[model samples]
Target: MRHLAFPLLFLAGCTRTADEPIDYDSLRAEACTSACAVIDTCDPDRFAGMDPEDCFERCSTLLPRLQEENQCGSREIIHLECLGKLTCDEFEQNEIGSDLSEPSSLDFDAPCVTELHWAVECDHKEPFNLDEPAPTAP
Candidate 1:
């Protein structure tokens, strides 16, 4: 019975046999939409070579959503992917190029973060606790 107990416990822990599902298509669409909106706010001729702020603003508006949705990785992907869509040489030459690192933590409150979170992953069926702060249990 003792031998069986450990094996059963182990099996119980391993019962689930799959990774989390990601609605990649929806996320991509959201990101592209937000990017288009931001781009619309700027002058294309003025924005093409000099302004990375316009691009960053769009990313900021989108990335947070992606993190909250558990698609934090998608934030990075969107930034890199936008290079192909928008030909802002400054962003490629200075902004993301200078850093290959990631943000230290996810901040869901920000619009870009929120957008990014949703753009990268789906808010799984699990409930979210927006009112409660993260617990720091010892």
Candidate 2:
């Protein structure tokens, strides 16, 4: 009985603790930061023409989807950025020597926004672990 009791106590102590509660507000802010960084890295021209704060506000709708899709990490951001840069480069190459003025800014519901999200989703190389807790800000 004593031996069994000791082993049970040891096993109880070794049991994993409950996971920390997710702070969605923080996650949203982090996602916004990551999204902005991707835009800045991939398409500086877009970043220059757009207001970051406005962009954040506009992107709020995407935050939930991004979090659900597990597309909110440094690595994921870098991947999306690279894909975006390539897409922009291709677009520029095709438009070479064309007399095109910069178009007026559009909101998150714009076609370009959908295209960017699609590009990231399609180009992601790794699968995120859904079982793991969402990332928290430092």
lDDT of 1 by residue, 52-127 (tens): 5354444444444434443233433343334224434422232332221343444443223332333234334443
State the lDDT at 109 in candidate 2: 33
- Model 1 RMSD to the real structure? 18.0
| Candidate 1 global lDDT | 0.34
What TM-score would every model get versus the actual structure? 0.26, 0.32
> Looking at candidate 1, what is the lDDT of residue 99?
27
- Pick out the ten consecutive residues of candidate 1 with the lowest summed lDDT: 1-10
State which candidate has the highest lDDT. 1
| Runs of candidate 1 exceeding 4 Å displacement | 1-20, 46-73, 77-138
Off by over 4 Å in 2: 1-17, 44-53, 62-138
- Model 1 per-residue lDDT at 48: 55
Q: Which candidate leads the pack in TM-score?
A: 2
